[model samples]
Target: MAYTGEVEVGGPPDVHELTDLIITKAAVGPMDNNAYVLRCRATDEQLLIDAAAEPHTLLEVIGADGIGAVVTTHRHRDHWQALAEVVAATGARTYAGRLDAPALPVPTDVPVDDGDTISFGRIRLTARHLVGHTPGSIVLVYDDPHGHPHVFTGDCLFPGGVGNTHDDPAAFTSLLTGVTAKLFDVLPDESWVYPGHGRDTTLGDERPHLAEWRERGW
Candidate 1:
């Protein structure tokens, strides 16, 4: 089937194959959180983004290859519900934004900051920090040499608008500003966005609505 990037809880994952990487996205937990398993085609080394929930399902997806690292996108509880179990089972190293690391259930082996590079096998992801939903929310960017860049947006950027800021104007502004400068400005429109939940969208698809999101002040 085509890679639509749409997934449902308890259903099969949607797999998107790149030149050198294989991205398998699955929706887990009652909240329908999306967890991505990125496997490097060259080495078969895998890295999981957002353990979210359903350790058994995640473990099944991981299989016998085992995971090398797990990254928690932010400090939100829903994002890391299965962190402990996943880590305990796979013994994967944990990575999260420095500011949000301490709050996570598992100890962060690598406390990342903006511009930090996370490597697993031949694949490399650049961590970009965007504050708003949480103080240390981050999105991982993989600039594929064979194709357009792909981003794993935790709870930061979604299909329609930015993540929730709890109606705080300052927070909303900060998030919007970071998103604009770090993402929209730096990346190309064709960049594929894999959000933390719901369906996927392209940067081109959401760029025109920036002002509207600002005016709405979500």
Candidate 2:
């Protein structure tokens, strides 16, 4: 079947192929958190984004090839519930946004800042820091040489609007500003957005609603 980017907990993952990379997205945990397994086609080196839950399931998806690194998108418990177990099992190094690194259950091997690169095999993802969802929430961007760019947005950008800010105007403003400048303004509308939970969306699909999102203040 074609990749639809829609997954359910306990269901099969949706897989997409790129020129040098293969992305496998799975939904795990009661919260329905999304975990992405990226494999480099040339070297087969694997990197996991968010070991959210169900270590056994994640490990199974990883297979015997093993993973080289795990990157937690933020400090949220739901996003890293299985971090310790997965890391312990695969002996994978951990990476997170510098500001949110101290709060994770596992030690962050690399505290990343904006513009830092996370690499596995021949592929690299650029980290873009977007504040307000958390002090250091980040989205990973893979500028595919063969196709449109793909981004892994961790609890920051979703299908309808930005992440929840609990009604705090300042926080909402900060998130919206960062998302607009760093994401919408920079990336092309064809860029694919892989969010932390639920289904995926593209920049083109959400761009027109920026004003509405700002006015609604969510």
Candidate 3:
């Protein structure tokens, strides 16, 4: 999709497959929040993550494709600024962790708890509740049958350290603890990290510096 200078829409209009899943990515809003479309090739059911901004572009990116659900990674306004618009346009059910669901502008059809499994077609994503950035912040883990795992961390685990803690020591500890235990310790080093904003990174690239991140403390 050609989005011109304002927004960069990367991925095929038809389908971009990774193993049995098809993924589409678009960077939207001034903040450049990533909006992802994940499809199960076997059934074509799709789940959209973070409809940050640019309703027209988001709706267009979704195109004629039917959306099974929309998940907002957290309660942050930047992440779901365009959520109401997208849901209105597509009629897709909305989901977020129970702790964070109350924060959204729209209603949630499903309150995703940690370890909750969301399945469509042959694709299954397990929700990992990683707190700190937000009380109910979640990371979706997809164990790709073909290769390594794929974890979509909203704003928790970035390429550098954990997501910004804004000098809140307690919050930082909460977020980093989740990242270290729930993510780093459990997931493989080869796990692909799809963040809420900016580019993607791998658990392998950010793991070795855990001690460094802890000592400095954001």
The stretch of ten residues in a row with the least summed lDDT in candidate 3 is 2-11
lDDT of 3 by residue, 1-218 (tens): 43221224443333345879977778876786888889888888888989888888778877687687999899999999999999998899999988999999999999999899988788999999977888899899999999989888999988888998888999999888889998899989999888887777889999999989988996
A best-first ranking of the candidates according to their lDDT comes to 1, 2, 3
Q: Which residue window of length 10 is worst by lDDT in model 2?
A: 10-19
Clashing pairs in 3: none
Question: How many clashing pairs in candidate 2?
Answer: 0
Writing each residue's lDDT as its tens digit, candidate 1 over 135-191 gives 999999999999999999999999999999998999999999999999999999999
User: In model 1, where is the ten-residue run with the lowest total lDDT?
Assistant: 129-138
TM-score of 3: 0.92
Scored by lDDT, model 2 comes in at 0.96
lDDT value, residue 4 of candidate 1 = 98
* Superposition error at 201 for model 3 (Å): 0.4
- What lDDT does the true structure give each of the candidates? 0.96, 0.96, 0.85
Instruction: Show model 2 residue runs off by greater than 4 Å.
Output: none
Clashing pairs in 1: none
